[model samples]
Target: MLMTERRAVVTGGCKGIGAAIATRLEADGLSVVRADLPAAAGAWRAGGGTAVDVDVSDTRSVDAMIAAAVGLLGGLDVMVNNAGVAEQRARVDAMPDSDWDRVISVNLGGAFRCTRAAFDHLRASGHGAVVSLSSTWGLGGVPGYAAYCASKAGIIGLTRAMAADGGPFNIRVNAVSPGYVANDMGGSLDGLDAEAAARAWAGRDLQASFQPLGRQCDVAEIAAAVSFLVSDQASFVTGTVLPVDGGQSNRLNTGEQQWPAP
Candidate 1:
């Protein structure tokens, strides 16, 4: 099918990576429905796309979002589960139960809700594709991010499971795992004071060295991966977690000395 004829809905499309994905898909000629909190509806409208106020953590909101998207677009071709939350840095023992629940509910549970709500519409389209945002930490592990890691890892598992079931309906499901990307979510350094922030940013440079590419990823780069996965070019791709993490997922931090000199 032609890209221009396609219709898509991107969760958390008000800002950050979600916004980037919405813009990228729109640029590819798809009619996009940007879904985020009710507070963000105006931003979506300003962008000249169909806007649906949705809180993915709530099934009712997800249902309404999908209905609105299908109604407005006439059908659904793509569903991007880009809505997620990050927990404050904490080990499992130190992490609050509330934080864990919130992260899991928004990250993993939200994806499940949106995907389930969009299933019927997607099945009807016969060319449906879903891209869930996972994380490089989900594939591996890192200290001080227990809940966040668990939630993202759950997304990867959910993506594969959905792909297996959705395959019969001619729907393809995939997960895009990204590394550190500059967005509203920022990185672990978020919320630090100027001096501490500077120190953290410098530390990030040391961390980036672990990634063979030696740099942080851009939100648009991640969006481009989503574009390809949902496009016809990836028709045969399904049940896969594609890491857009600049080799971060494949690397092990032996030491700074171990990194090849640029």
Candidate 2:
């Protein structure tokens, strides 16, 4: 299908990585509909994209958002399930049930609701694609992100299952797992004092040593990956988890190892 003839819906499309994906899709010549919280309506309008107020955790809201997207765009060709939330740093034992439930509901459950709502339109398009955001933390465990990790991991599983189900309709489903990108969510040095923040930022060299690429992923880089997965080039690509995490997923931390004079 031609880019100009495509229509896409991106949840959480008002800021951060979501905004980047929406912008990339728009640049690719697709009519983009950005569905975010009502508070983000202004940002979405400022970006000159059609905005829909949506709370992915709410079934009624999700259905309304999908209906609006389809109505506005005439049909849906791509669905980007980018809406998600993270809990404050806490171990599973210490975490509140509300925190866990909220994270799962918005991150994993939201993707499921959005995907299900868009299924018919996607199937009708015959060249439809869905890309859900997963995280590198989802692939492995992080010390204090139990809820967030579980939700993202669930998205990966859901993506695979949806791929199998959507295959008959020629709809592609995939997940993009991004490593730490410098965004509000990833770059947060929250709760740290100025000195601590500075020290942490200065220790980027040490942090980079743990990952093969020696740097954090960028929002645009991740968006580029999404662009490909939703485009004709990746027509044959589905039921796969693409990691854009600078090799963080496969890296092993050896901790301060030095070569003796190579």
Candidate 3:
């Protein structure tokens, strides 16, 4: 089926990568219900897409978001689990339990809630698709950011499990692990000094000078990756965490890519 005729739901579509993905999907002809923080005007700008306020960590909010998407957009053919949070950058020992819980609630818990709520509708789609947002931080090790890394890593496991569960129903579940992008909400970096932020993110020793791509990724690139996965092009793909990060995951000495921010 053409993407325009497909009904899709994209969480966290208010800004950054999520918004980019939503815009691309809409441009491809999909009818998208873009959900994000209440009063997010950017998400609504995705042409014909409808933007709804949704907090994925809450069960009722997620359910309502999905219900509205299905009822208004006609039925869910795609679900993009993009809503997530990053805990304050602190060592595990210094990280407060409250902060850790909050990260889990939004990053891990949010994905679980949204996926669960959309399962039946997606399963009914016959050839539905689910694209989750993950990060290299989820892979491992970032000195000051334990909760964020752990939460993102947990999402990988969750995505795989969902893939297994959705296989019988012909629904595809996959994830995209993106690296540093231009506009990021989770890290609060827009206000930082560019040089300091770059060093903090890339490290003085590793320097990131050798980074094959030589620069941070753009959000639109992430959207293209997601679009390919949702389109018929990736028909055989499922349960895979494809890193849209310009080979950093592969080139970062010993296949290690650290989290962009704490």
Candidate 4:
């Protein structure tokens, strides 16, 4: 069976990679429910996915969102742990405990909450899959992104642990680590309209110069990978950090080499 046919819930599904995951899942024939911040309902529904206002970090909201999604889709086969919050750039020395906690709560705690809430529905369905969104920055150092890095890195660890826990029940857990995607948090493009950001990344082609792919990846590509990981086709796959990045994580995009001096 393809992805769209499955009943899936994607948190943070109103925009960016979360939206892309929900869209791709829908394309694959899966009924999709998108749990996003309240303001995103109109946009989520407009895309043919059911939208619910949810703060994945909150236990009550997480429970409600999962229940609502199960109600809307008739049961759950997949849960994409894609909702996340990133902290502002700050020196590690100066980063507040609140900042660290906030990042941890949303990125790591949200995944825990959502997965916990959806466990029964997923297990009963027999092919329960959980795919989380992670970042290459989580694997390595990026100046000014200490808190963000810690949170995402924690996700990778959590994914592995979940895989072990869910294996007995036949639920597979995996994560996708994205690098240099043209999004507000992922690349040089911040606060720009999505179209402009896409154009700039594709037009500039800086991703390959250092990333090995020489291009920024669109959200769809990563979503497709996530979809595959959750699909039956990957039945044997579990407890992996699948890097959707074009090897950029291996070679940090340091700077342009000025071989030709002025």
Candidate 5:
């Protein structure tokens, strides 16, 4: 039987940006299988969607995840590499080897594993697409995010290289680079109380001086970019990193800029 509907797998899809992406894709009529860690999977209430368990950092786990998704969804058309982690901010001099390895294994290696595992399936779909999550920090640098920045920057490199490889197979690969988003992962606000989190969020707003949009991005906004890249609307697009960073990536944030009155 010909499956007319598209099928997708979203890593780290149980919550935050991944969840938003899964929900958005579902709304677009794709059958989505949300994959998170085994621990987090226990808490997933997929509602009308499907959920699975896999640790992106583990190759065996990632392979099992792809197999499970194929079994449940019948096939895969889109792969959203959104699973990642961030630890306490520390300067490079103080960063531990364990922290760097953990972040790289999950954030960068996970994307590579997932994409590679799904390569054959995507080729068979004849319209396979991949949208990975990068960050504005990936484009440049942050003082205390050595491992994180390296991992995300690696995603951009991986995206472009894989796009080239997938092109011959009719599989499009791209990435979305987002700016400061108020999420449990990116902003170091996971364990803070409401008041403290609010203050932290407020502090990040200083980017408004250089950011055109003048604020942080919502998860849904980032998901929208993922949605477009996966859809036929972007059939011709590949090997590109789309910035969902409110124009933050367009200019260097050297310091406060003085603009003439318009």
Candidate 6:
């Protein structure tokens, strides 16, 4: 069947990497639904795509959102679990329970909820695919981001597990682990003052120096990676975490190196 006949859902799809993924999927001829937080509904400026508000952390919200999306699209073929959050830097001992819980609930739990709610729709589609967003921190732990790291890492494990379960139904499940991306969540200083913005760029420069690519990733690049995984090109691929990081996953940080804020 033509990709134009397929349907997709991208959580947190109003901005950043999620927006990029949604756009790429739509460009590839898939009918896309951009699901995000209720407050972010107005942030979707793109046309020709359905936008839905969903708090992935809430079971009722996720279930209802999936129902609505399926009702709009008639069925679901791809599920992109991209809604996630990161808390500020803090030592594990100093990290508040609220921070840990919220991050896990939104990041890890959100992915699970979305996938579960959409599993049936995807299975019914006969050729289903799931792509979740992980992070470089999920692969190599970073200082002061225990909750974020753990949640992302859990995504990898969940992706593999889901892949195994979906194998019998021709459903593929995978993850994309992105390193530093030039986005608002990745330290972009869009609203920051001159000094803060400079500092942010300086930090990116320093990190880029250590990274083999000598630069951060573009949201479009990450979107492309996801695009392939959900397409027929990766029909044989499943249960893998594709690192969209610029070889950052291969580079090792020295124990004494100063780390970025979480």
lDDT per residue for candidate 5 within 1-262, as digits (tens), equals 1223999999999889998998889889889999998766667853544788999998999999999999999999999999999756899999999999999999999999999999999999999999999998898888999999999999999999999999999999999999877566643676789999888767777664468777788889998999999999898999999999888988766687647458
Give the alpha carbon lDDT tens digit for every residue of 114-163 in model 1: 99999988999998999999998897778999988999999989999999
What residue runs in model 2 are displaced by over 4 Å at the alpha carbon? 46-48, 186-209, 257-262
**Candidate 3 ranges with C-alpha deviation above 4 Å:** 41-49, 190-208, 254-262
Report the candidate with higher TM-score, 3 versus 6: 6
Cα lDDT tens digits for candidate 6, 1-262: 2389999999999888999999899899999989998767545634444688899999999999999999989999999999989988899999999999999999999999999999999999999999999998898678999999999999999999999999999999999999888887734376789999989878876785577676889999999999999999999999999998888888776634435657
Q: Ten-residue segment with the worst summed lDDT in candidate 4?
A: 252-261
lDDT tens digits by residue: candidate 4, 146-244: 888988998999999999999998999999999877564433477678998788766546544566665677889999899899888899999999998
Quote each prediction's TM-score. 0.92, 0.91, 0.87, 0.87, 0.93, 0.92
Any residue pairs clashing in model 6, and if so which?
Answer: none
Q: Which run of 10 residues does model 5 get worst, by summed lDDT?
A: 40-49
How do the residues 1-262 of candidate 3 rate in per-residue lDDT, one tens digit apiece?
Answer: 2576788888998677888988899888888878887767343644444688788878998888888788887788899999888877787888899999898999899999998999999888888899999997788688988888888899899999999999999999999998766665675765689987886666522534445665677888999989999999899999999998666676746545555654
Task: Please tell me which model should have the higher lDDT, number 3 or number 6.
Answer: 6
lDDT of each: 0.88, 0.89, 0.83, 0.85, 0.89, 0.90
* Superposition TM-score, candidate 6 onto the true structure: 0.92
Q: Candidate 5 — which residues are off by over 4 angstroms?
A: 1-4, 46-49, 257-262
Q: State model 2's lDDT.
A: 0.89
Among residues 3 or more apart in sequence or in different chains, the pairs in candidate 3 whose N, CA or C atoms overlap within 3 Å are: 4-29, 4-30
Question: What is candidate 1's CA lDDT for residue 73?
Answer: 94
Candidate ranking under lDDT, highest first, comes to 6, 2, 5, 1, 4, 3
